[model samples]
Target chain A: MPGVKKVGQRTIQFANPPVVMATASIVGPKEGEGPLADCFDKIVQDTYYGEKTWEKAETKMLAEAVEMVIKKAGLQTGDIDYLFAGDLLNQTISANYAARQLAIPFFGLYGACSTMYEGTILASILVDGGFAEKVVAATSSHHNTAERQYRYPTELGSQRPMTAQWTVTGAGAMLIAKEGSGPRITHATVGKVVDQGIKDPNDMGAAMAPAAADTIITHLQDTGRKPEDYDLIVTGDLATVGKALVEKLTQQQNIDLSKNYTDCGILIYDPSQDVHAGGSGCACSAVVTCSYLLEEMIAGKYKRILGVGTGALMSPCSCQQGDSIPGIGHAVVFEMS
Target chain B: MGANEGSLLDKQFQQVKKQAQQQQYQQMAQSVKPKQTWVKNAVAAFLVGGSITAFAQIIQNIFQSAGLAQKEAGTATLMIMVFLGAFFTGLGIYDNLGKFAGAGSIVPITGFANSIVSPALEFKREGFVYGVAAKMFTIAGPVLVYGFVTSVIIGLIAYFFQ
Candidate 1:
């Protein structure tokens, strides 16, 4: 059992990596109006997605994404073995309720914004280990639902700080299988929760950048690779501020990420969108990866990509009690033939 | 000093060094973080909030000119202002205004009405009794509680003095 699937320190090197069979994205009107609008499979005009409440709307979007991914793979719901998913809500109720509707064997996750990659790595491990032949990895975030739960009511006449990020109202899902002709999940490095003692809930980028840098560094060190090894290295939601910090932090460690590193938050929106720092939430990375990046990978634009899902692990309760925000970044490498 | 004491000294030194490094990281984060738009927000708040207060004064003046008592005119003006706030909130304009106005929109009577009405409208989907009624006072509850408590304290002081 020694060094069978494990890499140096805390990375998993899949001997036979699981393939991403299909991907589906369902985004809200605001996201649909953004730069990558045409990339998504479906775009709902309203944030409610025809549901009564924003919470129910988020559940619907996730459930639809899961079903769409399965259908895109030309498989029935009963054909999938496990469903790994999460969302940025209380008790992960969005994922839990969607699982109830989907009726698949489920593993409810709570990795804050980093949950999509967490689900991906776990799905890859299960598929690679021959435990589950096919499974679904998905996560969603609703702008109104996140606001009501984390900060204030959606219509509260409050101004967000310039450093504050706009949560993406969308869902992204992927079907991963043991044998498929698609981009394969090759390796992953799960990050440690790194807290640089940043306390402001508004400045989430700064809080998460250190963790992203640390995980990137460790991934490189563990796998004995360099930044040039991957065609593109993208962080989940560092936006502008955290992206700069990751560049600086990694540069200090003599690992120049200047050539290839980018952020999903920055890429998701244009400067005109006025998303201050940039787009965030679980859907930020998931939607961007499932839509834009995956399409590019299949089209031979990018062959090797290291997608780092970063998360600021502060709750409303923790921030209210004056505790510093802890951050995490989980990385998953995807390579196309 | 003995070997134990020397090792203790080294440990303390390491702790101090780590603390300094941590402080450096915090400062770096603060530096790179987008600076607060203090002047812009403050100016906008002043202009917007001041305009709202001035408009209320005009409304109060109009009621007084219509031959109402000063207290009656003030109450009527506030009611009009609250209605306008709730109206804009319902029409989905106040929150957008607030995004630019900052505290300017939030400090006025209209902002207060928006605070109460926003949650009421948002939570309406959950059910009237538990959703709207229960969540209505969430934003403005603290203001009402503290306002009443202070009034009671001042009233007690006045009673004892008299």
Candidate 2:
């Protein structure tokens, strides 16, 4: 049972680890102005992307990202056994519509901002379990669409508080296969929905920090690994506030995530951009991981990395009804093969 | 009373709530959740809001000096300010100003025009009926409803008192 697939309570160690064959990141104009502008596969000049609306643009981004990932792997669409995709829209219309166009076996997911790692975890499970040979995990989030759906109309002149994170307008896709020459997903940690009674929607980082800490703690305990074991550890969309909170929280658990830890939200945009706290959304992690992390891993900059996708599970109605924001964190360990 | 003074059930409830708060994480998050620049925002509001009002007054004075009646000048000033608000909103300038000016831009009549015009222009894509007409009042609707309600109630109270 030492090499057993089920490693611990919350983590699964793949006996046959799935390789990340390729990754593609497509970001909008605002994200293009960010520090990781050069890292993206394509920097779209228009939020509409020649589409009718921002939502449709998000759909196009996800579809193009999936197509681009498959192309980068030099594989046909028929080569991909299954496609896992999600977005922040209600009913995950972006994922569904994108899948509708892809014509592959699709799994529509909704984990808020954590959908990227959530899809990665699920895809890895399928590939590692000998279910499918090639599975592509893709997720997207548009700044305008997310803003209109969750907060306010895109053109609303209301000043967002400092804690409010700017939703990233981008899409990321990764082709995970049984055999590939790239980083392999070694261990996957499934996070539980952890709510800390944080009610402020603007303070998503605060809401998600505890959940990220919980998952990180669980992954560490289950794998018997320390913070120093990984070259880099990142939490998705936690931004500056959540990153700091995760550090202190993990320190309390004696995990000490300070030295090797960073956040996608903090990484995607520079402080000079005035993106309030930072970036948050499914694509915030998806884009950063698929682009910067993928490139760095391939360049041998990071040997092993832990990506924790953190999501605040709150709806506009729930927030309005005074329900606190519950959050989840899904972690995927990637090591250079 | 001792620091832990409470009923047994209260103590239990407090414990549960504390657990939900994820004590350390929540405290750390609260401590670092991005401090609001209250003073800076206030200063900006004062400067921008005052400037807008002064500009409106200058426009009114201009109208009056142009041989318009005092009441006509006041009415013209309101129209021009609202026109400017809507025009700038269409030009996509008011939103940017509103983002920076905060309450300064929002507390004025121009802000009210912006509140209405912004949604109308944004939702124009859904067509004039549902998109523009329906969503036009999204921001301004509440203000109109509450304003009218309060005014009617105040008028009734004043009439009864008199």
Candidate 1 clash pair list? none
Q: DockQ each candidate and list the results.
A: 0.76, 0.56
Interface Cα RMSD, each model: 1.1, 1.6
Candidate 2 lDDT by residue in tens digits, A269-336: 98998899999999999999999997999999999999999999999999999998999999999999
lDDT of 1 by residue, A128-247 (tens): 999999999999999899998888888889998888999999999999999989999999999999988889998999999999999999999989999999999999998999999999
Error of 1 at B10 (Å): 7.4
Query: How does chain B score by TM in each prediction?
Result: 0.84, 0.83
Candidate 2 lands at a TM-score of 0.95
Per-model TM-score on C-alpha atoms: 0.95, 0.95
Model 2's DockQ score? 0.56
List clashing residue pairs in candidate 2.
none
